[model samples]
Target: MLAIIGGSGLAKLPVLEVTHRQVVRTPYGDPSCALTFGHLGQQNVVFIARHGHGHSLAPHEINYRANIWALHNQGVKGILSIGSVGGIRADMGPGTLVVPDNIIDYSWGRKHTFFDGPERPVVHVDFSNPYDDGLRSRVIAAVDAAGKQAVSQGIYACTQGPRLETAAEILRLERDGADIVGMTGMPEACLAREMNLPYAHLCLVVNWAAGKGGSATVDFDPATAEAGMNDVTAVLQAMLS
Candidate 1:
């Protein structure tokens, strides 16, 4: 089965035919909220709102371990994380959908790994390629089949946030080779990997990075961002069906 982890613009699976909701408790603690089970056609899938039902959890405050662990223990074979991001690459301008192939972790002070303390031995997992390739291909194919234009690959930069990036910080991230910027991409991706679950992200380009495009002086248009999410949501629905 697949587990869909929704972020930002998506608080629930819009197309999921929800059968029931399950509250899963992990050794790491509770997940963001109860997991919603349903059939996106014939497939059995689960959904989780990463920021809790009220969308109150900050990116730094999200307990990524419990979220991933709950899904893993429930026999979820794979995870598809949907995130809203700011574009740094010109081609990845607002309203674009991308399947990120690589990621740079710029987040800190979060419980990132399951391997900790005296009981568990120190462990290092190879993160040379953060997102799973096969799963990425499936999503790209689904987008194409859905008649949506999606960028095949891009580099994701994960930042510590409740706060948006400064113009200068955006520049720094661009120099770091990031094509998109967002919160909630880090430890979640890594934690899924630690659990041996194949994970891939479907990113929606919600806006231009701080100084680029229209965001230099104007406030970010969240309405436009939400519309962009709708574009990707269609593809996600087609992907599952």
Candidate 2:
């Protein structure tokens, strides 16, 4: 079964055929929201809002362990995560869609690994290629099948934030070879790996990164970001179908 984890601009999927919501209890605690079972394009799929149903939790505050554990316990085999991002690459402007192949984590003070407790035992998982290659290919194929143009691969910079990045910070990320920037990509991707779930992400470029394009001199416009994400929603619907 496939699980869809929705981020900002997508708290709910209107296309999902309503089934039921299950509140899962995990060792780590509660997930952001209940596991939503439903169908997409007649295929059995589960949906969960990475934030709460009311969009209350911030990226840094999300309980990644519980979220992944709940879905895995429900027998979800593949995960498709949708997130909003800012373009760091010059060509990846607003309204662009991308499937990231790599990620750089600058986040700190978060429970990044499942092997932290004394009784848990230390275990290591090879993360040479952070994302599942086959799943990433499938998503790229889905995008093509939907006739939507998307950047086949890019490097995502995962930042620690309940706040937006500064122009200098974005520039530093660019220098570090990041193509896009966002919060909430780190432990989520890592935890999915630990769970052995096939995972991939669909990133929506909502705006230009700070110090790039026209955003160099001013703050990002929320209205423009929402408009760009609306286009992303259309593409996602088509791809899922």
Candidate 3:
């Protein structure tokens, strides 16, 4: 089965045919909430809201370890993580869908890996390519099949925040080659890699980043988010089928 980690603007999959909800305990602790099991199109899938159903948890407070472990423990073959982002690249404006090929983590002070403690052997996972290539291909193809267009490549910058970035910080990120900016993309992706799960990120550009698109301040529209998520649902359905 595949797992979908829903981020902001996507607390749940409305199209998912409900089956049951299962609460799971992990060595790291509890997941954000129960694992939602259901069918999307003809495929069986599981889902979890990254920030909890009520959007209570901030990006930094998320239990990344438990979330990934619970899904891995449930025997999911792969994971598709969806997040909302601010567009730094001019071409990637509001309401755009993008599949990031690389990531730069600016986040800190989070439990980023499971390789801690003396009992575990020393391990170093190669993150040369942050995302799973095969899964990325599948997502791109699914977007096409869904009759939607997604920018097939871009760089994701994961920030440590409940707060949005400052204009200067956004400038620095752009200089560092980040095409998009978001929170909650880090430890989650890295933890999945640690668990040997094929993982990929699908980003929804909700607004222009600070100092971009001729806007000094970032602004978001609920309607844009609604439309973008609608496209995401269609792509997910195609992926499942």
| TM-score per candidate, chains pooled | 0.96, 0.93, 0.97
Candidate 1, 93: how far from true, in Å?
1.1
Poorest stretch of ten by lDDT in candidate 1: 214-223
C-alpha lDDT of residue 66 in model 3: 95
The lDDT, on a scale of 0 to 1, for candidate 1 is: 0.89
Predicted candidate 3 versus true structure: per-residue lDDT over 1-241, tens digit per residue: 9999999989999999989999999999989999999999898899999999799899999999999999999999999999999999989999999999999999999999999998988799998898999999999999999999999999999999888888899999999999999998998888999999999999999989887864524378889989999999999989988
**Candidate 2 structure quality by residue, lDDT tens digits, 1-241:** 7899999888988778878988999999999999989877757889999998899999999999999999999999889899989899988987788899999999998888888887898889988888899988888877777667789889999999888788899989998999999898988999999999989998988878887866632545677667656655655566567
- Native RMSD of candidate 2 (Å): 1.9
Name the TM-score of candidate 3.
Answer: 0.97
**lDDT digits (tens) for residues 18-89 of candidate 1:** 899999988988888999999886689999999999898999999999999999989999999999888999
TM-score of 1: 0.96
Model 3: worst 10 consecutive residues (lDDT sum) = 210-219
Candidate achieving higher TM-score, 1 or 3? 3
Candidate 3: misplaced stretches above 4 Å? 214-218
What overall lDDT, based on C-alpha atoms, would model 2 receive against the true structure? 0.86
Highest TM-score scorer: 3
Who wins the lDDT comparison? 3
* Residue 171, candidate 1: C-alpha displacement in angstroms: 0.8
lDDT agreement with native, every candidate: 0.89, 0.86, 0.93
